[model samples]
Target: METIHLTYPETPDVVPSVMVLGFFDGVHTGHQAVIRHAQEQAERLNVPVTVVTFDPHPKQVLSNKPDAVRYITPLSRKLKRIESLGVERCLVLTFTKELAGLSPQQFVDDYLIGAGAVHVTAGFDYSYGKFGEGTMETMPFHARGRFTTSVVNEQTEGGEKVSSTRIRKLLGAGEVDAAATLLGSPYVICGEVIHGDARGRTIGYPTANVVMDASYVMPRLGVYATRVRLRDGRTFHAMTNVGRRPTFYDTGDVSIESHLFDFSEDLYGQLIEIEWVRFIRNERAFDGLDSLIAQLKQDETTARSILS
Candidate 1:
């Protein structure tokens, strides 16, 4: 898949294609449905499918407060997921104050019709233009007969809507198994292995400290059953802890430490992806090292059972 980055007032020469539009943060199940629908349209029209998404999130740029909006999948991971869906092109529009100020007609004219969009596909609730005044209901009118539009209605799982917000809430609440059900896959976070105090080694369970980008949404502060994949494609079953290590200190920075089962090779400075599978238990402070070691043993047993 080809990735094209664009800023407002700038355009790219392109071919007539079916445009799939959204700020697909997680590329979760509902987003998948929209992209798949666009894929079907592209197949019928014999045109390439161009996925149009925004970066840094519109909320981060538009919100008045200095709120950091966490993401389920960062830009790079999002593109990978979109490519896995067979998209031919990905157009990343850099969101800015100028682009956010465009009116409904101007946005369509500049971004859609003017860019060779023969057809557009988006979720039912998709919105555009200044203050989001343009929605799927108004997309056809904004098209001005230059292009057709298709709206994929709300996709649901277990009688509830499958959405990124809901998935984030699940991860926040440490319900990864439930989140995975809605996401159609495990929730994953990418990070680099960093040096730690080597405290786990003293306890016979050495761990790799995975430092991640602050933009990535973190699962609840607890241990979980996870699968770690290295950049070289090697994977292993692991038990990961997301906590502040209260057992060792009264207060400390929150950390992601994973003890890969049967792993012996060094991983420092290497990048890895951790796929959260199941929530084990809440993080807590143990009174003594012996107690913590016993619990670690128990956690390993439970995590192994779940991962297996």
Candidate 2:
């Protein structure tokens, strides 16, 4: 899919499309429904579906605590997910306070009607303009007879609305299995294999120390049944731990280390993706090295049962 970046006051000519609008952070199931509905409309109208999204998250610029704005899928991952759903093009608007201050009519005219949107599709709760004063209901009023709108209703899973907030809450609580049901896939973290203290090797269970971007919404600090995909597309069942090594240090920075089962090869400086499968146990300090090793052996057994 083609991606174009834009800022306010710069309107570029483009072909008419069935425009899908949202800041699709995770591209969760609900977001998928909206985009799929747009695809249907595009099929009927014989036009391509163009997704218009914002960058730096509006909350990053508008909220009092910008650093707290973590994401389920960061910009790069979100784009890949959107493209996997068959979106033809993407327009990423560089969000700023100036862009956020645009009046409802101005936003629609410049981003929608003026950008060659023949029809627009968004979730029911979608809104625009300064302080989000424009709702999908008000989209028609702003369309000015140049375009149409479709609002996909709330999508529910387990009797609750599927939302990014709910997913983040699940991840925060280490309910990755439950979150996967709502997300339609496993929660993933892409990171590099970095050097650690090389302590796991001493315990006969060498691990790859992964360091991901700070913007990712990390699963709760604990041991989890996980799958790790190497850069060469090799996947391995892993017993992953996300925590500070409490047994080694009284307190330290959080770390992600995964021991790939039956794998013994050098992986320093390589990139890998960790897919959370299920929660195993909370992180706890063991009495000694022998006790920690025993618990790790048990964790591996349980992870094998789950991933097998």
Candidate 3:
């Protein structure tokens, strides 16, 4: 797909394209439906399928507690997922105070019209412009003679709407299977391996420490069965932990540590993606190093069995 970063007054020259717009955080089933509709429309119209999304989610800019809000998929992962959907192009707009101040009509004129969109597709609940004044009712008026608008209804799974918020809740509660159903894939957190205290190595199960970015939502603190994909794209079944080592000392820093089963190699500084498969148990303080090591061994066995 031809992905581009767009800004007001610096829009691309492509025109008469079918465009899909939204945060598309996790690119969940609902997001997929909208993208599919846009792609189908583009195919029928013989135009390019373009996706419009924002970077640093608007919520981060508008919320008072922006730092506290977590994301279902970081920008990199979101782009990968969207590209996998076969869209011809993706445009990421940088959300800023000045851009956020644009009125609904101005947003349409500046972005939709400027991007040369002949038609636009988005979720039914999608909104835009300063203070979110843009709505389904207002889209057509804003488009006027410039473009057409289509709204895809909310996608439901088991009688409930599939959404990034709901998926995050499921993941935070350790409901990996449910989150997967909503996400259309396993919930993954990827980051570069960083230096750690080397405590896991002393226990015979060396672990790769992943330093998660603040944008990504973290799963419940506990041990889980996971699949680790390395930078080389090779995936390995593994056991993962998200917590502080209470048995050793109370540092209070939440760490995501993964032990690749039966695999050992230098991994520091390499990007690793961890896919959660199942929840094993909640994190707890052990009596001593020996007890913790024993529990880790048990967790490894459980993880292997679950992955198998």
Check candidate 3 and list the clashing pairs: none
Q: Give the least accurate 10-residue stretch of model 3, judged by summed lDDT.
A: 6-15
List per-candidate RMSD values in Å: 1.0, 0.9, 1.3
lDDT of 1 by residue, 1-308 (tens): 99999998897676799998999988999999999999899999999999989987988898885367889998999999999988999989999999999998898898888889999989999999999999999999999998999999999998999999999999999999999888778999998999999989988999999999547888999999999998899999999999999988899888999999999999999999999999999999999999999999999999999988
lDDT of 3 at 170: 96
Candidates arranged by TM-score, highest first: 2, 1, 3
- Which runs in model 2 stand beyond 4 Å of their true positions? none
Please say which candidate is ahead in lDDT: 1 or 2: 2
lDDT of each candidate versus the true structure: 0.92, 0.93, 0.88
Q: How good is model 3 by TM-score?
A: 0.96
Task: Tell me each candidate's TM-score.
Answer: 0.98, 0.98, 0.96
Instruction: Give stretches of model 3 more than 4 Å off.
Output: none
Error of 1 at 47 (Å): 0.5
The model with the greater lDDT, 2 or 3, is 2
